[model samples]
Target chain A: MGVFTIAKTITGNLFSRPPTSRYPAEPAKRFDLTRGHLAFEPENCRVCRVCMLRCPTQAIVVDREKRTWECDHFRCITCGNCVELCPTDALHLEPAYRSPEADRPGKEFHEIPAPPPKAEAGGETAEA
Target chain B: MAYMKRSPWIIHYDGSSCNGCDIEVLACLTPLYDVERFGIINTGNPKHADIFVVTGSVNEQNREVIRNIYEQMPQPKVVAALGICACSGGVFRECYNVMGGMDKVIPVDVYVPGCPVRPEQIIDGVVKALGVLEEKRARMKAGAPAEVPA
Candidate 1:
Protein backbone atom coordinates (compact mmCIF):
# COMPACT_ATOMS: atom_id res chain seq x y z
CA MET A 1 0.00 0.00 0.00
CA GLY A 2 3.02 2.29 0.31
CA VAL A 3 6.09 3.17 -1.80
CA PHE A 4 8.31 1.22 0.63
CA THR A 5 6.09 -1.85 0.23
CA ILE A 6 6.52 -1.69 -3.56
CA ALA A 7 10.29 -1.35 -3.20
CA LYS A 8 10.42 -4.25 -0.75
CA THR A 9 8.32 -6.47 -3.03
CA ILE A 10 10.68 -5.75 -5.95
CA THR A 11 13.75 -6.56 -3.85
CA GLY A 12 12.21 -9.78 -2.54
CA ASN A 13 11.26 -10.93 -6.03
CA LEU A 14 14.81 -10.35 -7.23
CA PHE A 15 16.46 -12.26 -4.36
CA SER A 16 14.06 -15.06 -3.43
CA ARG A 17 14.26 -18.55 -4.92
CA PRO A 18 11.39 -19.44 -7.25
CA PRO A 19 8.81 -21.59 -5.48
CA THR A 20 7.79 -23.60 -8.55
CA SER A 21 8.72 -27.26 -8.71
CA ARG A 22 10.56 -28.36 -11.85
CA TYR A 23 8.43 -31.43 -12.42
CA PRO A 24 8.44 -33.35 -15.74
CA ALA A 25 11.95 -31.98 -16.19
CA GLU A 26 12.79 -33.42 -12.77
CA PRO A 27 11.24 -36.32 -10.89
CA ALA A 28 8.34 -35.54 -8.55
CA LYS A 29 8.84 -36.29 -4.89
CA ARG A 30 6.00 -38.63 -3.93
CA PHE A 31 5.48 -39.52 -0.30
CA ASP A 32 6.03 -43.04 1.07
CA LEU A 33 2.31 -43.89 1.14
CA THR A 34 1.26 -41.96 -1.95
CA ARG A 35 -1.42 -43.91 -3.78
CA GLY A 36 -0.48 -43.07 -7.32
CA HIS A 37 -1.27 -46.34 -9.03
CA LEU A 38 -1.90 -50.02 -8.42
CA ALA A 39 0.34 -52.99 -9.18
CA PHE A 40 -0.84 -56.57 -9.57
CA GLU A 41 1.78 -59.23 -9.08
CA PRO A 42 0.27 -62.19 -10.82
CA GLU A 43 2.86 -64.52 -9.33
CA ASN A 44 1.64 -63.83 -5.86
CA CYS A 45 -2.05 -63.69 -6.81
CA ARG A 46 -4.05 -66.76 -5.95
CA VAL A 47 -6.86 -66.06 -8.47
CA CYS A 48 -8.84 -64.70 -5.54
CA ARG A 49 -11.63 -62.30 -6.45
CA VAL A 50 -11.32 -60.33 -3.25
CA CYS A 51 -9.82 -57.30 -4.97
CA MET A 52 -12.57 -57.31 -7.55
CA LEU A 53 -15.25 -57.48 -4.87
CA ARG A 54 -13.51 -55.04 -2.59
CA CYS A 55 -13.18 -52.34 -5.24
CA PRO A 56 -15.80 -49.66 -4.60
CA THR A 57 -15.72 -48.57 -8.22
CA GLN A 58 -15.63 -52.10 -9.64
CA ALA A 59 -12.55 -51.12 -11.64
CA ILE A 60 -10.94 -54.52 -11.24
CA VAL A 61 -12.24 -57.50 -13.16
CA VAL A 62 -10.89 -60.91 -12.16
CA ASP A 63 -11.66 -64.04 -14.16
CA ARG A 64 -10.41 -66.84 -11.98
CA GLU A 65 -11.51 -69.49 -14.44
CA LYS A 66 -9.33 -67.96 -17.15
CA ARG A 67 -6.59 -66.86 -14.73
CA THR A 68 -6.77 -63.29 -16.00
CA TRP A 69 -6.96 -60.03 -14.07
CA GLU A 70 -7.85 -56.73 -15.70
CA CYS A 71 -8.16 -53.16 -14.46
CA ASP A 72 -9.76 -50.18 -16.07
CA HIS A 73 -7.28 -47.40 -15.43
CA PHE A 74 -9.65 -44.55 -15.95
CA ARG A 75 -12.29 -46.09 -13.77
CA CYS A 76 -9.96 -46.74 -10.86
CA ILE A 77 -10.07 -44.09 -8.11
CA THR A 78 -6.67 -45.22 -6.72
CA CYS A 79 -8.31 -45.51 -3.31
CA GLY A 80 -6.04 -48.48 -2.36
CA ASN A 81 -9.07 -50.50 -1.35
CA CYS A 82 -8.08 -53.40 -3.58
CA VAL A 83 -4.49 -53.21 -2.39
CA GLU A 84 -5.57 -53.21 1.22
CA LEU A 85 -7.95 -56.13 0.76
CA CYS A 86 -5.62 -58.41 -1.14
CA PRO A 87 -5.15 -61.53 0.99
CA THR A 88 -1.98 -62.73 -0.75
CA ASP A 89 -0.51 -59.19 -1.05
CA ALA A 90 -0.68 -59.58 -4.81
CA LEU A 91 -2.17 -56.13 -5.23
CA HIS A 92 -0.22 -53.13 -3.93
CA LEU A 93 -0.12 -49.40 -4.45
CA GLU A 94 2.77 -47.85 -6.38
CA PRO A 95 4.07 -44.39 -5.66
CA ALA A 96 4.65 -43.69 -9.35
CA TYR A 97 1.47 -42.55 -11.08
CA ARG A 98 0.31 -43.51 -14.56
CA SER A 99 1.55 -41.05 -17.15
CA PRO A 100 -1.13 -39.21 -19.08
CA GLU A 101 -1.44 -40.45 -22.63
CA ALA A 102 -3.70 -39.92 -25.66
CA ASP A 103 -7.48 -39.69 -25.36
CA ARG A 104 -8.05 -43.43 -25.34
CA PRO A 105 -8.96 -45.12 -22.08
CA GLY A 106 -6.47 -47.71 -20.81
CA LYS A 107 -7.31 -51.16 -19.54
CA GLU A 108 -4.58 -53.59 -18.49
CA PHE A 109 -5.00 -57.35 -18.55
CA HIS A 110 -2.39 -59.61 -17.04
CA GLU A 111 -2.18 -63.37 -16.89
CA ILE A 112 -1.77 -64.91 -13.49
CA PRO A 113 1.71 -66.31 -12.97
CA ALA A 114 2.00 -69.90 -11.76
CA PRO A 115 2.78 -70.40 -8.12
CA PRO A 116 6.19 -71.88 -7.31
CA PRO A 117 6.21 -75.65 -7.09
CA LYS A 118 6.99 -77.48 -3.86
CA ALA A 119 10.50 -78.94 -3.49
CA GLU A 120 11.05 -82.70 -3.47
CA ALA A 121 10.19 -84.55 -0.24
CA GLY A 122 12.10 -83.19 2.81
CA GLY A 123 13.60 -80.32 0.65
CA GLU A 124 13.36 -76.68 1.65
CA THR A 125 10.56 -74.68 -0.05
CA ALA A 126 11.63 -71.93 -2.48
CA GLU A 127 11.03 -68.47 -1.09
CA ALA A 128 9.43 -65.89 -3.32
CA MET B 1 0.20 -22.71 -34.19
CA ALA B 2 2.60 -20.04 -33.04
CA TYR B 3 -0.07 -18.21 -31.05
CA MET B 4 -1.62 -21.37 -29.62
CA LYS B 5 1.82 -22.80 -28.81
CA ARG B 6 2.52 -19.75 -26.68
CA SER B 7 -0.72 -19.42 -24.80
CA PRO B 8 -3.63 -21.73 -24.13
CA TRP B 9 -6.34 -20.55 -21.80
CA ILE B 10 -8.28 -23.06 -19.71
CA ILE B 11 -11.77 -23.24 -18.22
CA HIS B 12 -12.28 -25.29 -15.07
CA TYR B 13 -15.65 -26.65 -14.02
CA ASP B 14 -16.63 -28.76 -11.05
CA GLY B 15 -19.48 -31.17 -11.50
CA SER B 16 -20.75 -33.61 -8.87
CA SER B 17 -17.71 -34.25 -6.65
CA CYS B 18 -16.26 -34.09 -3.17
CA ASN B 19 -14.18 -30.99 -4.16
CA GLY B 20 -10.86 -32.74 -3.47
CA CYS B 21 -9.93 -32.84 -7.17
CA ASP B 22 -11.04 -29.25 -7.53
CA ILE B 23 -8.40 -28.17 -5.00
CA GLU B 24 -5.72 -30.10 -6.86
CA VAL B 25 -6.76 -28.42 -10.09
CA LEU B 26 -6.32 -25.06 -8.41
CA ALA B 27 -2.98 -26.24 -6.96
CA CYS B 28 -1.57 -26.51 -10.47
CA LEU B 29 -1.94 -22.75 -10.72
CA THR B 30 -0.01 -22.14 -7.51
CA PRO B 31 3.72 -21.31 -7.50
CA LEU B 32 4.83 -24.75 -6.30
CA TYR B 33 3.53 -26.52 -9.42
CA ASP B 34 3.15 -23.35 -11.52
CA VAL B 35 1.39 -24.59 -14.67
CA GLU B 36 1.66 -21.04 -15.94
CA ARG B 37 5.24 -21.85 -17.00
CA PHE B 38 3.68 -23.77 -19.91
CA GLY B 39 1.66 -20.64 -20.78
CA ILE B 40 -1.58 -22.12 -19.51
CA ILE B 41 -4.00 -19.52 -18.29
CA ASN B 42 -7.08 -20.41 -16.30
CA THR B 43 -10.18 -18.55 -17.38
CA GLY B 44 -13.82 -18.75 -16.38
CA ASN B 45 -15.41 -17.99 -19.73
CA PRO B 46 -15.59 -21.00 -21.99
CA LYS B 47 -15.47 -18.93 -25.18
CA HIS B 48 -11.94 -17.73 -24.38
CA ALA B 49 -10.70 -21.15 -23.28
CA ASP B 50 -8.68 -23.53 -25.43
CA ILE B 51 -8.80 -26.32 -22.84
CA PHE B 52 -11.74 -27.47 -20.74
CA VAL B 53 -10.62 -28.98 -17.43
CA VAL B 54 -13.40 -30.76 -15.59
CA THR B 55 -13.31 -32.28 -12.12
CA GLY B 56 -15.83 -34.71 -10.62
CA SER B 57 -18.51 -36.82 -12.23
CA VAL B 58 -21.33 -35.92 -14.61
CA ASN B 59 -24.50 -36.14 -12.66
CA GLU B 60 -28.08 -35.55 -13.81
CA GLN B 61 -27.95 -31.96 -12.61
CA ASN B 62 -24.68 -30.94 -14.29
CA ARG B 63 -24.81 -32.81 -17.59
CA GLU B 64 -26.49 -29.93 -19.39
CA VAL B 65 -24.06 -27.45 -17.94
CA ILE B 66 -21.03 -29.40 -19.16
CA ARG B 67 -22.51 -29.88 -22.61
CA ASN B 68 -23.25 -26.18 -22.94
CA ILE B 69 -19.73 -25.25 -21.89
CA TYR B 70 -18.18 -27.62 -24.40
CA GLU B 71 -20.53 -26.30 -27.06
CA GLN B 72 -19.52 -22.73 -26.32
CA MET B 73 -15.86 -23.38 -26.95
CA PRO B 74 -14.51 -22.97 -30.48
CA GLN B 75 -13.15 -25.81 -32.51
CA PRO B 76 -9.67 -27.20 -31.72
CA LYS B 77 -10.41 -27.16 -28.00
CA VAL B 78 -9.39 -30.01 -25.69
CA VAL B 79 -11.13 -31.47 -22.67
CA ALA B 80 -9.23 -32.90 -19.70
CA ALA B 81 -11.01 -35.17 -17.22
CA LEU B 82 -8.95 -34.40 -14.13
CA GLY B 83 -9.64 -37.28 -11.75
CA ILE B 84 -11.23 -40.69 -11.37
CA CYS B 85 -14.57 -38.98 -10.86
CA ALA B 86 -14.43 -37.06 -14.11
CA CYS B 87 -12.85 -39.97 -15.94
CA SER B 88 -15.33 -42.65 -14.82
CA GLY B 89 -17.46 -41.16 -12.05
CA GLY B 90 -15.21 -42.55 -9.25
CA VAL B 91 -17.15 -43.77 -6.19
CA PHE B 92 -20.21 -41.93 -7.33
CA ARG B 93 -20.90 -43.99 -10.44
CA GLU B 94 -23.41 -46.07 -8.55
CA CYS B 95 -25.14 -43.09 -7.02
CA TYR B 96 -28.70 -42.58 -8.20
CA ASN B 97 -28.03 -39.00 -9.23
CA VAL B 98 -24.75 -39.74 -11.00
CA MET B 99 -24.83 -40.43 -14.73
CA GLY B 100 -21.07 -41.35 -15.01
CA GLY B 101 -17.95 -39.74 -16.52
CA MET B 102 -17.32 -36.49 -18.31
CA ASP B 103 -17.19 -38.51 -21.49
CA LYS B 104 -20.83 -39.27 -20.98
CA VAL B 105 -21.60 -35.66 -21.81
CA ILE B 106 -18.69 -34.45 -23.92
CA PRO B 107 -15.52 -35.67 -25.62
CA VAL B 108 -12.56 -35.88 -23.27
CA ASP B 109 -9.02 -35.61 -24.65
CA VAL B 110 -7.08 -36.64 -21.55
CA TYR B 111 -7.75 -38.55 -18.36
CA VAL B 112 -5.71 -38.18 -15.13
CA PRO B 113 -6.79 -40.98 -12.84
CA GLY B 114 -6.47 -40.45 -9.10
CA CYS B 115 -8.66 -40.09 -6.05
CA PRO B 116 -8.02 -36.35 -5.83
CA VAL B 117 -5.66 -36.07 -8.85
CA ARG B 118 -2.19 -34.84 -7.95
CA PRO B 119 -1.13 -31.47 -9.30
CA GLU B 120 1.68 -33.08 -11.30
CA GLN B 121 -0.75 -35.53 -12.87
CA ILE B 122 -3.13 -32.71 -13.75
CA ILE B 123 -0.27 -30.88 -15.44
CA ASP B 124 0.68 -34.04 -17.33
CA GLY B 125 -2.92 -34.40 -18.44
CA VAL B 126 -2.91 -30.83 -19.71
CA VAL B 127 0.27 -31.52 -21.71
CA LYS B 128 -1.40 -34.49 -23.32
CA ALA B 129 -4.43 -32.31 -24.04
CA LEU B 130 -2.18 -29.83 -25.81
CA GLY B 131 -1.22 -32.59 -28.21
CA VAL B 132 -4.85 -33.37 -28.87
CA LEU B 133 -5.50 -29.69 -29.45
CA GLU B 134 -2.82 -29.70 -32.13
CA GLU B 135 -4.41 -32.70 -33.80
CA LYS B 136 -7.83 -31.05 -33.67
CA ARG B 137 -6.40 -27.92 -35.26
CA ALA B 138 -4.83 -29.94 -38.04
CA ARG B 139 -8.05 -31.78 -38.66
CA MET B 140 -9.96 -28.54 -38.75
CA LYS B 141 -7.48 -27.06 -41.25
CA ALA B 142 -7.87 -30.18 -43.37
CA GLY B 143 -11.65 -29.66 -43.39
CA ALA B 144 -12.25 -33.17 -42.11
CA PRO B 145 -15.42 -33.68 -40.14
CA ALA B 146 -14.74 -33.66 -36.40
CA GLU B 147 -15.76 -37.19 -35.51
CA VAL B 148 -16.06 -36.77 -31.78
CA PRO B 149 -17.74 -39.69 -30.01
CA ALA B 150 -21.35 -39.25 -29.03
Candidate 2:
Protein backbone atom coordinates (compact mmCIF):
# COMPACT_ATOMS: atom_id res chain seq x y z
CA MET A 1 0.00 0.00 0.00
CA GLY A 2 2.94 2.37 0.56
CA VAL A 3 5.96 3.29 -1.60
CA PHE A 4 8.49 1.84 0.91
CA THR A 5 6.54 -1.40 1.43
CA ILE A 6 8.14 -2.97 -1.65
CA ALA A 7 11.62 -2.15 -0.42
CA LYS A 8 10.89 -3.57 3.06
CA THR A 9 9.67 -6.88 1.57
CA ILE A 10 12.77 -7.30 -0.61
CA THR A 11 15.12 -6.70 2.32
CA GLY A 12 13.33 -9.17 4.63
CA ASN A 13 13.52 -12.01 2.07
CA LEU A 14 17.25 -11.44 1.46
CA PHE A 15 17.94 -12.50 5.08
CA SER A 16 16.16 -15.88 4.97
CA ARG A 17 17.49 -19.20 3.66
CA PRO A 18 15.59 -21.34 1.15
CA PRO A 19 13.06 -23.52 3.02
CA THR A 20 13.49 -26.94 1.31
CA SER A 21 15.46 -29.62 3.12
CA ARG A 22 18.05 -31.90 1.47
CA TYR A 23 17.79 -35.03 3.62
CA PRO A 24 19.47 -38.51 3.32
CA ALA A 25 21.94 -36.76 0.97
CA GLU A 26 23.00 -34.35 3.66
CA PRO A 27 23.03 -34.85 7.45
CA ALA A 28 20.00 -33.20 9.03
CA LYS A 29 20.11 -30.78 11.95
CA ARG A 30 19.12 -32.84 15.00
CA PHE A 31 16.40 -31.93 17.47
CA ASP A 32 15.25 -33.11 20.87
CA LEU A 33 12.76 -36.05 20.81
CA THR A 34 12.85 -35.92 16.99
CA ARG A 35 10.17 -38.32 15.69
CA GLY A 36 12.22 -40.47 13.36
CA HIS A 37 12.95 -44.13 12.66
CA LEU A 38 13.08 -45.83 16.05
CA ALA A 39 16.55 -47.30 16.39
CA PHE A 40 16.72 -50.57 18.35
CA GLU A 41 20.26 -50.99 19.65
CA PRO A 42 20.17 -54.66 20.47
CA GLU A 43 23.65 -54.61 21.96
CA ASN A 44 22.33 -53.03 25.14
CA CYS A 45 18.79 -54.46 24.88
CA ARG A 46 17.99 -56.59 27.88
CA VAL A 47 14.77 -58.01 26.36
CA CYS A 48 13.00 -56.52 29.38
CA ARG A 49 9.71 -55.89 27.47
CA VAL A 50 9.61 -52.31 28.81
CA CYS A 51 9.45 -50.78 25.28
CA MET A 52 6.77 -53.31 24.39
CA LEU A 53 4.70 -52.65 27.50
CA ARG A 54 4.83 -48.83 27.15
CA CYS A 55 3.97 -48.62 23.41
CA PRO A 56 0.39 -47.31 22.92
CA THR A 57 -0.58 -48.93 19.60
CA GLN A 58 1.05 -52.32 20.30
CA ALA A 59 3.40 -51.38 17.45
CA ILE A 60 6.19 -52.68 19.59
CA VAL A 61 5.95 -56.50 19.67
CA VAL A 62 8.09 -58.79 21.77
CA ASP A 63 7.68 -62.56 21.42
CA ARG A 64 8.77 -63.81 24.83
CA GLU A 65 8.76 -67.36 23.48
CA LYS A 66 11.14 -66.36 20.68
CA ARG A 67 12.91 -63.58 22.64
CA THR A 68 12.55 -61.09 19.79
CA TRP A 69 11.52 -57.38 19.51
CA GLU A 70 9.77 -55.80 16.54
CA CYS A 71 8.15 -52.53 15.54
CA ASP A 72 5.73 -51.97 12.65
CA HIS A 73 6.80 -48.51 11.57
CA PHE A 74 3.68 -47.85 9.47
CA ARG A 75 1.64 -48.16 12.67
CA CYS A 76 4.05 -46.34 15.03
CA ILE A 77 2.87 -42.97 16.38
CA THR A 78 6.47 -41.81 17.06
CA CYS A 79 5.43 -40.71 20.54
CA GLY A 80 8.86 -41.70 22.05
CA ASN A 81 7.02 -43.34 24.93
CA CYS A 82 8.93 -46.60 24.51
CA VAL A 83 12.31 -44.87 24.59
CA GLU A 84 11.30 -42.91 27.67
CA LEU A 85 10.15 -45.98 29.57
CA CYS A 86 12.91 -48.40 28.53
CA PRO A 87 15.39 -48.96 31.35
CA THR A 88 18.17 -50.23 29.05
CA ASP A 89 18.24 -47.12 26.79
CA ALA A 90 18.16 -49.62 23.92
CA LEU A 91 15.35 -47.95 22.04
CA HIS A 92 15.63 -44.33 20.93
CA LEU A 93 14.61 -41.96 18.11
CA GLU A 94 17.12 -41.53 15.31
CA PRO A 95 17.90 -38.28 13.42
CA ALA A 96 17.18 -39.78 9.98
CA TYR A 97 13.43 -39.42 9.35
CA ARG A 98 13.21 -40.82 5.83
CA SER A 99 13.09 -44.61 5.49
CA PRO A 100 14.59 -46.75 2.74
CA GLU A 101 12.16 -48.41 0.25
CA ALA A 102 9.96 -45.34 0.60
CA ASP A 103 8.45 -45.55 -2.90
CA ARG A 104 8.09 -49.32 -3.30
CA PRO A 105 4.52 -50.48 -4.02
CA GLY A 106 2.55 -53.25 -2.21
CA LYS A 107 5.64 -54.51 -0.39
CA GLU A 108 5.19 -53.28 3.19
CA PHE A 109 7.85 -50.61 3.78
CA HIS A 110 9.52 -49.52 7.05
CA GLU A 111 9.50 -53.05 8.42
CA ILE A 112 10.33 -53.83 12.02
CA PRO A 113 13.99 -54.81 12.07
CA ALA A 114 14.25 -58.52 11.29
CA PRO A 115 14.31 -60.55 14.51
CA PRO A 116 17.95 -60.68 15.54
CA PRO A 117 19.46 -63.75 13.86
CA LYS A 118 17.99 -66.63 15.84
CA ALA A 119 20.66 -68.75 17.51
CA GLU A 120 18.41 -71.81 17.47
CA ALA A 121 17.35 -71.37 13.83
CA GLY A 122 19.59 -71.32 10.73
CA GLY A 123 19.70 -67.86 8.97
CA GLU A 124 22.20 -65.37 7.53
CA THR A 125 23.93 -63.67 10.50
CA ALA A 126 27.16 -63.33 12.52
CA GLU A 127 28.04 -65.76 15.31
CA ALA A 128 29.45 -64.89 18.74
CA MET B 1 -13.99 -14.36 -8.41
CA ALA B 2 -11.33 -12.21 -10.02
CA TYR B 3 -9.89 -11.12 -6.65
CA MET B 4 -9.84 -14.69 -5.35
CA LYS B 5 -8.25 -15.97 -8.55
CA ARG B 6 -5.50 -13.38 -8.17
CA SER B 7 -4.54 -13.64 -4.47
CA PRO B 8 -5.64 -16.72 -2.54
CA TRP B 9 -4.73 -16.76 1.15
CA ILE B 10 -4.48 -19.88 3.34
CA ILE B 11 -4.20 -20.45 7.07
CA HIS B 12 -2.13 -23.59 7.93
CA TYR B 13 -2.75 -25.09 11.35
CA ASP B 14 -0.92 -27.95 13.11
CA GLY B 15 -3.37 -29.41 15.64
CA SER B 16 -1.22 -32.05 17.37
CA SER B 17 1.24 -33.15 14.72
CA CYS B 18 4.55 -34.88 15.26
CA ASN B 19 5.94 -32.10 12.97
CA GLY B 20 6.81 -34.42 10.01
CA CYS B 21 3.68 -33.15 8.24
CA ASP B 22 4.35 -29.65 9.50
CA ILE B 23 7.72 -29.52 7.71
CA GLU B 24 6.19 -30.89 4.50
CA VAL B 25 3.43 -28.25 4.60
CA LEU B 26 6.10 -25.58 4.94
CA ALA B 27 8.00 -27.21 2.06
CA CYS B 28 5.04 -26.62 -0.26
CA LEU B 29 5.28 -22.86 0.33
CA THR B 30 9.04 -22.86 -0.26
CA PRO B 31 11.28 -22.68 -3.36
CA LEU B 32 10.63 -26.34 -4.31
CA TYR B 33 6.96 -25.73 -5.15
CA ASP B 34 7.07 -21.93 -4.91
CA VAL B 35 3.30 -21.84 -4.28
CA GLU B 36 3.69 -18.06 -3.93
CA ARG B 37 3.92 -17.91 -7.73
CA PHE B 38 0.22 -18.76 -7.71
CA GLY B 39 -0.27 -15.86 -5.28
CA ILE B 40 -0.98 -18.25 -2.39
CA ILE B 41 -0.10 -16.84 0.99
CA ASN B 42 0.17 -18.85 4.23
CA THR B 43 -1.18 -16.64 6.96
CA GLY B 44 -1.28 -17.09 10.73
CA ASN B 45 -4.46 -15.05 11.15
CA PRO B 46 -7.63 -16.94 10.22
CA LYS B 47 -9.93 -13.94 9.56
CA HIS B 48 -7.81 -12.97 6.53
CA ALA B 49 -8.16 -16.33 4.79
CA ASP B 50 -10.48 -17.98 2.26
CA ILE B 51 -8.78 -21.39 2.83
CA PHE B 52 -7.86 -23.47 5.87
CA VAL B 53 -5.16 -26.18 5.61
CA VAL B 54 -4.91 -28.33 8.72
CA THR B 55 -2.43 -31.10 9.62
CA GLY B 56 -2.19 -33.46 12.61
CA SER B 57 -4.81 -34.98 14.89
CA VAL B 58 -6.87 -32.41 16.79
CA ASN B 59 -5.58 -32.70 20.35
CA GLU B 60 -7.37 -31.55 23.51
CA GLN B 61 -5.17 -28.45 23.68
CA ASN B 62 -5.86 -27.32 20.10
CA ARG B 63 -9.49 -28.41 19.31
CA GLU B 64 -10.92 -25.18 20.78
CA VAL B 65 -8.57 -22.92 18.84
CA ILE B 66 -9.12 -24.97 15.67
CA ARG B 67 -12.91 -24.68 15.93
CA ASN B 68 -12.77 -20.96 16.78
CA ILE B 69 -10.44 -20.30 13.87
CA TYR B 70 -12.70 -22.13 11.43
CA GLU B 71 -15.68 -20.11 12.67
CA GLN B 72 -13.79 -16.82 12.29
CA MET B 73 -13.14 -17.27 8.56
CA PRO B 74 -15.49 -15.35 6.27
CA GLN B 75 -18.17 -17.32 4.44
CA PRO B 76 -17.56 -19.14 1.13
CA LYS B 77 -14.36 -20.63 2.52
CA VAL B 78 -12.86 -24.12 2.10
CA VAL B 79 -10.90 -26.45 4.39
CA ALA B 80 -8.24 -28.87 3.02
CA ALA B 81 -7.05 -31.22 5.72
CA LEU B 82 -3.51 -32.37 4.90
CA GLY B 83 -1.76 -35.64 5.93
CA ILE B 84 -3.24 -38.86 7.34
CA CYS B 85 -3.31 -37.29 10.80
CA ALA B 86 -5.78 -34.60 9.79
CA CYS B 87 -7.69 -36.99 7.56
CA SER B 88 -8.60 -39.72 10.07
CA GLY B 89 -6.09 -39.49 12.92
CA GLY B 90 -3.63 -41.51 10.75
CA VAL B 91 -1.32 -43.49 13.04
CA PHE B 92 -2.20 -41.57 16.20
CA ARG B 93 -5.90 -42.45 16.41
CA GLU B 94 -6.13 -43.87 19.93
CA CYS B 95 -3.95 -41.53 21.95
CA TYR B 96 -5.41 -40.37 25.26
CA ASN B 97 -5.27 -36.64 24.38
CA VAL B 98 -5.88 -36.84 20.63
CA MET B 99 -9.45 -35.90 19.59
CA GLY B 100 -9.15 -37.87 16.34
CA GLY B 101 -8.78 -35.88 13.08
CA MET B 102 -9.50 -32.20 12.44
CA ASP B 103 -12.70 -33.26 10.66
CA LYS B 104 -14.02 -34.41 14.04
CA VAL B 105 -13.62 -30.75 15.05
CA ILE B 106 -14.63 -28.93 11.78
CA PRO B 107 -16.03 -29.81 8.38
CA VAL B 108 -13.31 -30.63 5.83
CA ASP B 109 -13.87 -30.00 2.13
CA VAL B 110 -10.83 -31.81 0.69
CA TYR B 111 -8.56 -34.44 2.18
CA VAL B 112 -4.93 -35.03 1.11
CA PRO B 113 -3.95 -38.29 2.75
CA GLY B 114 -0.36 -39.48 3.27
CA CYS B 115 2.04 -40.26 6.10
CA PRO B 116 3.27 -36.76 5.40
CA VAL B 117 1.69 -35.84 2.07
CA ARG B 118 4.21 -34.71 -0.53
CA PRO B 119 4.43 -31.06 -1.65
CA GLU B 120 2.75 -31.82 -4.95
CA GLN B 121 -0.23 -33.29 -3.09
CA ILE B 122 -0.43 -30.20 -0.90
CA ILE B 123 -0.48 -27.99 -4.02
CA ASP B 124 -3.18 -30.16 -5.58
CA GLY B 125 -5.28 -29.89 -2.42
CA VAL B 126 -4.99 -26.07 -2.38
CA VAL B 127 -5.96 -25.91 -6.06
CA LYS B 128 -8.96 -28.08 -5.23
CA ALA B 129 -9.96 -25.73 -2.45
CA LEU B 130 -9.85 -22.83 -4.92
CA GLY B 131 -12.09 -24.76 -7.27
CA VAL B 132 -14.58 -25.32 -4.43
CA LEU B 133 -14.68 -21.57 -3.88
CA GLU B 134 -15.47 -20.94 -7.55
CA GLU B 135 -18.24 -23.53 -7.44
CA LYS B 136 -19.75 -21.94 -4.31
CA ARG B 137 -19.69 -18.52 -5.93
CA ALA B 138 -21.62 -19.89 -8.91
CA ARG B 139 -24.15 -21.50 -6.58
CA MET B 140 -24.66 -18.22 -4.71
CA LYS B 141 -25.26 -16.35 -8.00
CA ALA B 142 -27.79 -18.95 -9.17
CA GLY B 143 -29.57 -18.98 -5.76
CA ALA B 144 -28.68 -22.66 -5.39
CA PRO B 145 -27.07 -22.13 -1.96
CA ALA B 146 -30.40 -21.20 -0.37
CA GLU B 147 -33.41 -23.50 0.37
CA VAL B 148 -31.42 -26.65 -0.23
CA PRO B 149 -32.88 -29.80 1.40
CA ALA B 150 -31.06 -31.79 4.12
The best candidate by lDDT is 1
Candidate 2 recovers a fraction of native contacts equal to: 0.07
| lDDT (CA) per prediction | 0.83, 0.68
Whole-model lDDT, candidate 1? 0.83
Off by over 4 Å in 2: A1-128, B1-6, B144-150
Candidate 1: tens digits of C-alpha lDDT, residues B21-100: 89988888998998888888999999999999999999888899999999999887888988888888888899999998
What does candidate 2's lDDT look like per residue over B1-150, in tens digits?
233465679998888888887898888777756677778999988989988988888988898899999999887777888776786675678878887767687877777655676666676677777877777667778877621222
Instruction: Give chain A TM for each model in order.
Output: 0.80, 0.62
Q: Give the Å error, residue A44, model 1.
A: 0.5
Q: Mind sharing the TM-score for model 1?
A: 0.88
Give the root-mean-square deviation of each candidate in angstroms. Answer: 4.6, 9.7
Interface RMSD of each: 1.4, 7.8
The true-versus-predicted C-alpha distance at residue A36 of model 2, in Å, is 18
DockQ of each: 0.63, 0.07
